[model samples]
Target: MAKRWTAQDVLDLARLYQPAGVLTAAAVLDVFSPLLAKPMTAEELAGRLSADPRATAILLDALTALKFLSKQDEEYSVPEDVAGLLAEQSADNVLPMVRHLANCLRRWAELPKVIQTGKCAETGLGFRGTDADRADFIGGMNTISRPVATGVIDKIRPLKFRHVVDVGGGAGTWTIALLRAVPRARATLFDLPAVIPIAGQQFAEAGLTDRVNLVGGDYYTDALPEGADLAWLGAICHQNSRRQNRDLFTRVHTALTDDGVIVIRDVIMDSSRTSPEAGALFAVNMLVATEAGGTYTFDEYREDLREAGFDEVILVHQDEFMNSLIRARKT
Candidate 1:
């Protein structure tokens, strides 16, 4: 049977519509930033931010609906539970993520070739040319992966691994999270040359420069650097066809030591394909937004890993949502 999202899940998603939820919290800590300690009229707040009041109000309502706030009259305030995240703003603020989704990466039309041939370039979902897009992608990736990276770090702690390679890592969120969890660990991030500079800046801002090594290379054409006890592919597999997916595994097999491990985190559907409504909808969104990106079932993911050289692929639930971890060991 398929897994169905509860009413709470829907409520949780509705909360993401807030324009200034994270933005408001981020600004709170800056000497020049506005504070959200109390409920303020959306019109007055929007005027100060030079944003549209109507749109801001809609976002506020969405945030309130998600239980992030308690709204009385026309004013809103963050809940005690989430106050810590919103109470302060700094370089570590997650506001970049909220703004990136609202302003940039607004779910553009899918690439034609992905529909026709099912393959995206190193740059998935476009956003490569314009400066605005570039900024959104970099910031969005860092924010989105922050929580996910934290989750992976905790899961892999039991296993004794020294080094990790994050293939197609966007801004090294995984690297930072992993290194944070494992103080003794070091990491390498592999990505396109263009994206590497921005990632390096993130690493510097995070004060993790000494712990990570950034490598610029293509996963399809170039050889994946090896010798790390573990490597990871985060949210990257969905952007390829069957042939291309296998090719990536073959590369990882070659790059790893005899008993190295590769961990994959993505929206893996249940066997019935009817469960996990979120994953199914996500797959459709992938169709609408990209040429080749998708969400695959665990069975589908395992078949690929098995074909590549792995002895076993174990799945771990990261959250109550469709997101899960696939741990494969090269034996």
Candidate 2:
């Protein structure tokens, strides 16, 4: 059954962006890091951040109300639980994800214009600007994915491969997971030139540097590094149109050995495209973020794969979000 809406509920839903705005603003301003060091009055924080004192005070109060900070007398500090996720000093920090979401919040705010023009919204760098935003986006991928990669790879255990090409492999999170799963396997991590260095650093940290080759090139125009028996496309399909996916699949087919397989990890929508609430909302995210990108259904995947010289297409798993798995063999 559908949800029955009430007036109060409707108003509550409409006002959801308030908290998100406050949180994103705080993240963009990097309010948590300084507070993690020591409690300070709003004036001190504002002076350290070079922000408006009055505005900083209001923002700090909002963060305190949201339980992201603790207030004592006139001083404010990050709460322990929030500090673990938001403070840069913490080993398990998700500050990058918070910063990335701040970028998304900017694009999402222009949804009305996108809907009117049928084009992606124009996004601007908030607070810190381009380099930090790019770093945050890539780092956010690792922050969210590294923890779950092992469990997801475990689902397809006993997986053997001599060489695997990790397409658009950001920060080598998935490549590290795959190589760790199959000890003898080697991988070619292909992404944009800007991302290769970051992935190289991660590969070194994972102690898998010798086993992986770092290749930097745009997969859309440049040929993928060939000779791989397996290809892994993690969370990349949703950022393209069906035609683009078919072209990409064709490239993967050519890059693979005769019997090589391709495994895609992304959201797999139902026929309705609405059953998985996350996938549906993510489609809207693509709407504001890309010219022609959205979540796809299994049938769409099967058709695209088949058209690209791939056979035996099957969805190995159906996840509500990016964990869904689809497999196809080069025919």
Ten contiguous residues minimizing lDDT sum, candidate 1: 26-35
Taking all chains together, each candidate's TM-score versus the true structure is 0.67, 0.98
lDDT of 2 by residue, 301-323 (tens): 99999999999998898887889
Question: Each candidate's root-mean-square deviation in Å?
Answer: 6.6, 0.9
In order, the Cα lDDT scores of the candidates are 0.69, 0.92
| lDDT for position 272 in model 2 | 93
Candidate 2 error regions (>4 Å)? none
Cα-lDDT of candidate 2: 0.92
Distance from true location, Cα of 122 in model 2, Å: 0.7
Q: In model 1, what is the error at residue 62, expressed in angstroms? A: 12
